[model samples]
Target: MNKKEKSLLAAVVVGVGVAVFKYFTDRPKKQSIKSLFYLNDFSSISKNFSKEEIEREILKIYKEEINLDDKFKAILFLTMIEGIESLEKYNQMAQETLEEYVKQSSKKFLRINKKKKTGRNIYRENFYDLIEATCEPSSLKADIKLGIEECLNGNFKKGQDIFLSSTNSDKNTFVSLVICYFSDELEKLDKSAHKRHVKNALKDDKFLFLKSYIMDKNNMYKEQIDLLNSIEPQNELQENLRLQHLLINLIKTSDIENKNVNLVNEMIESFLSKKHETTNTVLNIIGISIEWSIINENIDFVKKISDMYLQGDIDTYVDCRLYVFTYLIVNFVEKLSEKNKQNFNFMHLNTDKVEILRKGIENNETYYKLYVYLGGETKDISVYKKALDICITKNEFINIMRILLVTETQNKILQSNK
Candidate 1:
């Protein structure tokens, strides 16, 4: 009741209020499920930490985040991470998460809007950066894994069937199917069927990235850039794809000394470059850039890049393997032909490297063409016939012509000997 007591009570009240406010304001915010959307975050972490450390952090997050949305995101994250062979040890956990995901996702809680939106599209909105449109697709991770396994085992028809069967149900599956069709591992896909699937895949707006990849394959650099520019990238993969194709377009269209090439290189290096080992993914981009450099006859740039990143164990990378083959074949062919030998430096053919590359590659039809070419050079009638058979089977009209030329020359030599 005294003035002193009243003042003390007032001070105590203010102190309690201040303490409560500080507690609420300084407390951590609940982690958002959207954090899993940008895989670049995990990629950056993986670069710095061991896989066990990353898995511990991820598992801690999964355990702490009990909210359904965050839980589903964690499951999908596990699936995505498990897809990388580095985290193959997480296989058991991935299956458990996947089963739980299927159980929960089968409920009618998630609403899917099939009608196209004006920007970014629904898959980005609902799945947070994942390219899948529905929960059903995520559940098909096992099938996708099997298809990839089949492809790796060189069962092209079985792999193609596994992928094609799931295409009607999921955009992710359809994209995988398209990628396998073009990939060297599974080269036996019927051309018409692949084209049809590509046509259908393009009907979906999210497939613009896939379309750009196809455009790049066809040498439509300008068109590919224009198409990529139309939409914003939803995730790290799309963003990387955009940057890569843009760099490729610059290389294909611009002179080697163009400043725009440097600009794109800086942008790409910001994301892709490492002080030590570069990733297989980065090697693929670099490999394609080298290929375009070869096409442009910028041998200086090619040599510089080859020396820089082409060190270490590159044999496992398909694009880099092809780059080596292309470099060797072009060098040999140019020197052998009088008309084309002017611009190219007379680089000695390293037959040892060629044999090593050939052994490293699997049963790829594209690289097999090199064998056909070598067989043609032998000029034996039996070799020529075998080469012709391959050229016809694979629809290599240029190789077919070369084989016929060898046949004609052999015939003339035989008649003269007789």
Candidate 2:
């Protein structure tokens, strides 16, 4: 190779930068993004280039139809086009040229900003980000008062959901309760079903601080100390995270800190699985039914709960099917509407629901989406069917899912028999 060419190759290897023109070879010409029109003296870009050739080139760049990874290259091409176009326009008629460019750009910028502010995002809207309203008719205090009133409760499962849906640092304890309660229900069947979720929640980064905060509010200092010990903070406490630390410290210093395990556990669970505004809203609609049931021991509570059971969305409670089973357990004997009564043969599930669920194993895998997403994977109907019977409340969906799998398993069994 020639000495000059060798020098260039050596420079590239050392990561010494060179001009764009010098670095590139016969790869291709580095033209402006806008190729349609010759902003450069048209005759200079190409002596053979007609006005049509220049216009087409400029159009390609103007649309930015193709994506470019090198933004600076794009800016350089755009600026070059802008300067050439402006010069040409001014040379034709200065007044009209300035007026048109200013008016067009000003309108476009204003339109884009207005659309952004109003949140009228057409391209960005999708179900993934859509927030849906949740409802659960059974819960305490947030719906009823301290007095001994007949309060018919609605959905405890939803209460569990409100707790788990949270992901905030301050919501750690709340998230944990939802997980614990659901996990408890899931565990009744097989620990294998919910073990992953439990492990993940335990490993969550913000859990210890949130737990400490909950214990402090519940006047459980010892618990607070335990949670604080669990956390390993970096550097000093952050200004935003200082409250969590302060609460933990307060618990440690409070009187009788040694003797309140029961109160503290209750307090911690309450803090972890409650939502103020949502609970309030839920109660406002169905408070009477739930509160009435609690006060008078009414049979109608069953019907009120049954409708909620069918219509309820388990996702609110970390997608726990236990809530459904738990609800069904109560509503089974509570009292039912005529239609539900006919279908509600499982009313005394203490005797029948388990059998039905047991019988369903022959038709397993018919439960619901909850089993598929949360119950991990299983080929045997035994583990899946077992998951449904023991899940605390409204566990029907997942139970049904597990039971339906029997159809699949049965076919395979028959084929082997053949």
Give a tens-digit lDDT track for model 1, residues 151-203.
43334457666776774533563554355333433444566755655555555
Q: Give, for candidate 1, the lowest lDDT window spanning 10 residues.
A: 119-128
Candidate 1 clashes between residue pairs 3 or more apart in a chain or in different chains? none
Question: Model 1 lDDT vs. the true structure?
Answer: 0.49
Give residue 408's lDDT in candidate 1 (0 to 100): 51
Superposed Cα deviation of residue 208, candidate 2 (Å):
7.0
Worst 10 residues of 2 by lDDT: 125-134
Backbone-clash count (model 1): 0
How many backbone collisions does model 2 have?
55
Q: Compared with the true structure, what per-residue lDDT tens digits does model 2 show for residues 330-378?
A: 4435464566446443333443434333333323232333343223334
Highest-scoring model, TM-score: 1
